[model samples]
Target: MSARLEAINITCRDHAASGARWAEILGLEPEGDITSANDFITYRIPGTEVYFAFQPPDNGEVGDTFVPRIHLDAVASGNTREQELENLLTRGMKLVVDARTADGAGWFTVEDVDGTQICVGRSDEERAAAKAAREGSS
Candidate 1:
């Protein structure tokens, strides 16, 4: 049987700092403190069951270290896109770029504290479709 994913673990130079950054960026709540006994801090994103664990680098050469190749995508209400984007910036995310699609939809890319790129926002059409789906279901 196939299983569901629960959490994603990432390595950084400092787990606590990374965890704190992620907590603020994603509106998550960290459950444990990163310590010598447990070198990880698990942060759970609210309204979801997923968790993200941040830890220190594994054994390797000075220059050879864990570089995450993952990217995260999130959807926001069309009207709240600007507010959410501002919140992400306030939480230490660096904006890479922002552009509008041919259909006049907008999207942006930002880098997290660990340099992991995350894409937030959606095209205007996509936002409208999502809203329509939600309203139809309700």
Candidate 2:
């Protein structure tokens, strides 16, 4: 059996606010309540079958707490190279890693309001070339 990605759980200092930010970024409407005994809220990216959930930080002082590292990577559609970067920036994303090169290659790594790192990339020509190569091999 193979493992599949279904949901990602993120611990945020402010779970509700983090949920709202992720909902806006993913063009989704969040559901659930952090105060409803569950202490978490979820945002689902429809048609993609993926869910992002925001939960309260671990119970303890920072020095005694364990925070898990969480990062996600995604591919953007339409345009090439910097279009996803522009869209993310317009939506108030903070740039973390400037992976773009002078030769017009590479991708980007950005952070959300809750400091969740997400790497996004778009390259039509490169993808097409790779697809063609794969098809040729097939």
* Best candidate, lDDT: 2
Error of 1 at 95 (Å): 36
Global lDDT of each model?
A: 0.65, 0.67
Candidate 2 Cα RMSD (Å): 10.6
Error of 1 at 86 (Å): 44
lDDT of 2: 0.67
Position 100, candidate 1: lDDT: 46
Q: What is the model-wide C-alpha lDDT for candidate 1? A: 0.65
Instruction: Give the best candidate by TM-score.
Output: 2
